[model samples]
Target: MTQNPPIRRALLPATALLAALALAGCSGGGSVRVAAPVTTGSTAEQCAALKAALPATLQGRKLRDTTPESANTAAWGNPAITLRCGVGTAAVLDPHSPAYDLNADIEESGGVCWVSEQTAGGGFRFTTVRQQATVELTLPAAYAGGQSPVGLLAGAVLKADPVVRDRPFACV
Candidate 1:
């Protein structure tokens, strides 16, 4: 009677185990969904024009330039207390950017500030680039002043509108 070789049997199981380990290691970890900044126009004047066109709820907000991490953590339509909670959860999802300043400034006044992305340095290394945008929001009004403006804006923006646009980028 013919019998299988021990070395061949060992190799098969070892190969399978190695393959499984490789697959597990390849999977990315701590992936969070983040919104990308947008460019509506050029120059501060154009910025003002763009701001004017945003939904009325966002009109009163300020304008500032900051990082992508800062972009997704602002308050959109409510007070600081609620905004703080939203920011905490939102930051976990958005990606961080070092190029732009992620700006937000009061356009008209009344506890409001418009936050978005501004064009800055370009070209970098990344496995893939993702495109995301801030959209409509519903905030709680009032925020603790100690927080950075960027964080405030991103969280506020998300709270203002939970829904937004998303895209992907592959840096070559």
Candidate 2:
């Protein structure tokens, strides 16, 4: 039996570890799956503008590619802080809609207002309030105790989607 060199012995473990990590990453973890919203005409144009203005990173997470590859959707991080532009107005924001909530906590950060609702998964989904083209963000439960991620995208959203003056909802 021949003994392997010290460097070769060390390289064997490292190489094996690398291969294992690569396989783990290939098992449906590389890209996030997000439902893309349908938009047309001016809304589609606004979504495109918002996409262009999005930051390359959010919080400390580098932006990752989303599945289905839509210009209307973006994501960041493993748990994924996802954004879908040109979404339909949520019922909570519609005064005439039965789902409207008079006591909704409309939060304002970085000059944009949002209506947040908790999801069944313990995460939170926030939608832009009173914007021409609604933008929705889904924050994973892992981010619950952290600082608000909304401020990071505020500038982009503010520039891309003008406020709908006719809408009754507004951040107090």
Candidate 3:
């Protein structure tokens, strides 16, 4: 009987990962399905629009199917880049007393503005500043790179709802 070469077997995992990534671009295949962020009424409507505009793939990860199938929340990749729309005001948003100093923690990237805070587990929390129903995103430390989630989320949402950036606040 003939058998595959050792080198072929060694390449299996890498081959599988590439296949999965290609599938992700088609649908949110490789993404982790998370519980939808809770919302009601018009808030839900707004989030739905944001959801509709979210990319099929994010940061080389697919946008996974979320639990409860809600437009309020989304996740991508294994480490799980989670994004929640229609979020309540974050304590750091208080311009009078920001959770962190200006431009230090809260900075703009890819045209999206956010206030960042490190999670206890060493992950990061990035929340939108100018939008009405705040959008919060969480990413693991290893995912840190030039490709910012802020830019992606903001582009998707703003394109869907041009006026979503209501109630702008200054972190001065």
Candidate 4:
């Protein structure tokens, strides 16, 4: 029986491959980074909750009075507070239309509409109306008073209403 020469593998190529893998491990792998959980619930409840949960800094802060007058189209958050929703702007379904008129006084809009609330901090936030079954909610880290706004909002909503539904709201 003839014994074949012991197969010898190249060490340089193997070492290079190992080094590459180690470098990749040191860097970021193909792993996905999971963000904080987004809570979803009734649009109105959530809105009211967030509004009531606003920190002291934002509670009395007067935002630009740009809320719409239409009951259906208007925002439903704290009457005194305002967020930068950029309302009163005309909608543009087609920007390249031959009749495209930027000077039109008509008020048109798009996207999920809803009332906005001020964060515990100075930032203003709002919840998007759900065209479907669920609405996503991102809680701020702290209010202007350095407190979690989500918990406060949730508590307020719960206290105000005995039974709060996690369903979409007709506000939008």
Alpha carbon lDDT at 142, candidate 4: 35
Can you tell me which runs of candidate 1 are displaced by over 4 Å?
A: 1-4, 25-172
Cα-based TM-score, every candidate? 0.20, 0.82, 0.68, 0.22
Predicted structure 1: lDDT: 0.30
Candidate 3, 19-113: lDDT as tens digits: 88888776535436665667887667778888888998887877776665777888887667888888876666666664535444667665556
Candidate 3 lDDT (Cα, 0 to 1): 0.72
- The residue pairs in collision within model 2 are none
lDDT of 2 by residue, 1-172 (tens): 6667997898999999999889968753577889999889999999999999999989978788888899899998878899999888877767799978878889888888899988788898899977888999999998987887899899999899877788777787
Q: Rank the candidates by lDDT, best first.
A: 2, 3, 4, 1
For model 4 the local lDDT of residue 23 reads: 86
| Root-mean-square deviation of every model | 19.0, 4.6, 7.4, 19.9
Count of residue pairs whose backbone atoms collide, per candidate: 47, 0, 0, 6
| Candidate 3, position 44, lDDT | 79
**Which one wins by TM-score: 2 or 4?**
2
Candidate achieving the largest lDDT: 2
TM-score of 4: 0.22
Give the poorly placed runs of model 4, Cα more than 4 Å off. 1-9, 33-167, 170-172
**Best first by TM-score, ranked:** 2, 3, 4, 1
lDDT-better candidate, 2 vs 3: 2
